[model samples]
Target: MTEQNVDLGKNPRANRIPWPPLLLIASIAAGALATWVWPLPWPGINDGPAHGVGLGFGVAGIALIVWAIITLRKRGTTFLPDGTATSLVTSGPFARFRNPIYLGDALIVLSIAEITHSIWFVAAALLFGILVTALQIVPEERHLESQFGDAYLDYKSRTRRWI
Candidate 1:
């Protein structure tokens, strides 16, 4: 695939503080609040199954997130997208996908929506993914491409953005 062509030298929004984690938190809060505002029931599934599904997805998502953090920590790299990258992580979860954390974020969003059984929550989840990808992931990728050059290009070529 062709790389995204963005002018880093003249970009005006590069100095802004990153808010990906805050966005994730807001998404979760919005979901929970939405459940309170318009709590709905699953069409055919029982409460037990719903809870089980939510718990399953939530735990797995949490685990994935933790794993990604641990990986970054073990490698002594910055998890913050806005910061400088210290290493080109390509092991563990990184070996599988370029963005395990983002995948985990999506999963967590899914789990929250599932648990709440709220259409509004699901909408928030979708918005969460879209916003993160556009605001955080895109910038991070651009930085990685610039910082790591051909190495990142090779990694990006081999790995999927979100698997």
Candidate 2:
């Protein structure tokens, strides 16, 4: 039997942000701000119908987070800012989208905004996600391409960046 090995170079820009730690901090900050500044309205204090809509958004956001986590775990992947992969995963949720984590994060943010009925926050989150993806995600893709080459390229071609 013969084994073929492929070399994927080390990513120069990997682990840029210490993402897990940063994510924790950001989550705390966001939660604090939301609590201090724009706390959820007390039930019966606002329009009844709109409450249902808001709750739906909140639920959707939670659902997306759960789905994203499951996908990552099943694929043996992480959402770290750095683009490092133990293996090329082209199955499960990844088969449908190139960046399920990003999509899920965006959905959660948008859902929170909608739930809060904060147009300003919704727009801000959308812009933030776009910028983060551009600055962080795109470069990571470049690194993946450098490493995985044609396989990554084929995956890129087949999967949508955000869907």
Candidate 3:
């Protein structure tokens, strides 16, 4: 039997616990809480214009997420962390970032940092990136590699994981 035919079933890693969105939420909450309890005196621009820019970043992030979702649904693919993807999405934001949703999440975190004037949120964004990469992206990549074989490999070769 061919390698691709080994397990063309539901994603093997779908059963893993601690969903990606939950991880992101946890990271953001932790950062916000930390900032509230122990505000970091980081010296940087976090004023009216900065907050406005932060809001803009948040809008952009939300827009990216919505665009991705629309593209995925149109392609008949799943966006849920545990749901099986029906196809390898390679258009829209996927063309630029392999994990646009995660990128959006990062942008939202940055938004929080700027809006709240807290460096803790910046750290939170980084932590979220590392955690999601380890807990979600890696598994999803493996699953996609198994599901789409060379098509996915080729896409991975051309697409950036995050941008």
Candidate 4:
């Protein structure tokens, strides 16, 4: 993709701050607050099956995140969204998904929702996904497309954004 092809100027807020972790934290806090103030009855949240599902998802999410981080580090690329990526990494978890870390984050949010028995966390997860897409993923994609050009585009085409 050409520089002109990617509209980096569409969201000014995206480039200003490190939003991913902050957004995740904010979502969790909001969910927790909501749960405290107005706890909704989630029927199966306390069940053994629900806890098992949450545990499984949490493990998978953490594993995916760690794998992605290791892959980026091994390739000498910056995993931080705001940092300049030294290399276009397309191995390990990256081979399967362009945004494995973000996917992991999303999974962790779901895990939290299940573990905490909070319907509000499910809402938070949805909100977090939407906000991160607009504020982090879109900008990051534009930057990558601009920085890596056709190679990034090709990788993007072959690999799903989230799996």
TM-scores, one per candidate: 0.81, 0.68, 0.89, 0.87
- Per-residue lDDT tens digits for candidate 1, residues 3-114, read 3334434332321566677888888888778778777674535588778888797888788888988888788776775565656788878888888887788788887776
After superposition, the stretches of candidate 2 with alpha carbons farther than 4 Å from their true spots are 1-5, 12-15, 18-53
Listed per model in order, the count of residue pairs whose N, CA or C atoms clash below 3 Å is 0, 0, 0, 0
Best by TM-score: 3
Clashes of 3: 0
Candidate 1: lDDT of 107? 81
Alpha carbon lDDT of each predicted model: 0.74, 0.59, 0.83, 0.81
lDDT of 3: 0.83
List model 3 lDDT by residue over 40-117, tens digit each: 886667577877889998999899999989888888767888877668888889988999998999999988888878
Q: How many angstroms is residue 73 displaced in model 4 relative to the true structure, after the best TM-score fit? A: 0.3
Residue 134 in model 2: shift from native, Å?
1.7
Error of 4 at 139 (Å): 0.6
Backbone clash tally for model 1? 0
lDDT of 2 by residue, 1-163 (tens): 1111156455544447654334433543564476567665433325767667666655765665567566566666554666465455666556777666655555566555555555544544566566666666688678777666777788889888767
Query: Superposing all C-alpha atoms, what RMSD in Å does each candidate have to the true structure?
Result: 5.0, 5.4, 3.7, 4.6
> What is candidate 1's CA lDDT for residue 149?
74
**TM-score leaderboard ranking:** 3, 4, 1, 2
Global lDDT of model 4: 0.81
List residue ranges in candidate 3 displaced over 4 A: 1-7, 10-15
- Compared to the true structure, candidate 3 yields what TM-score? 0.89
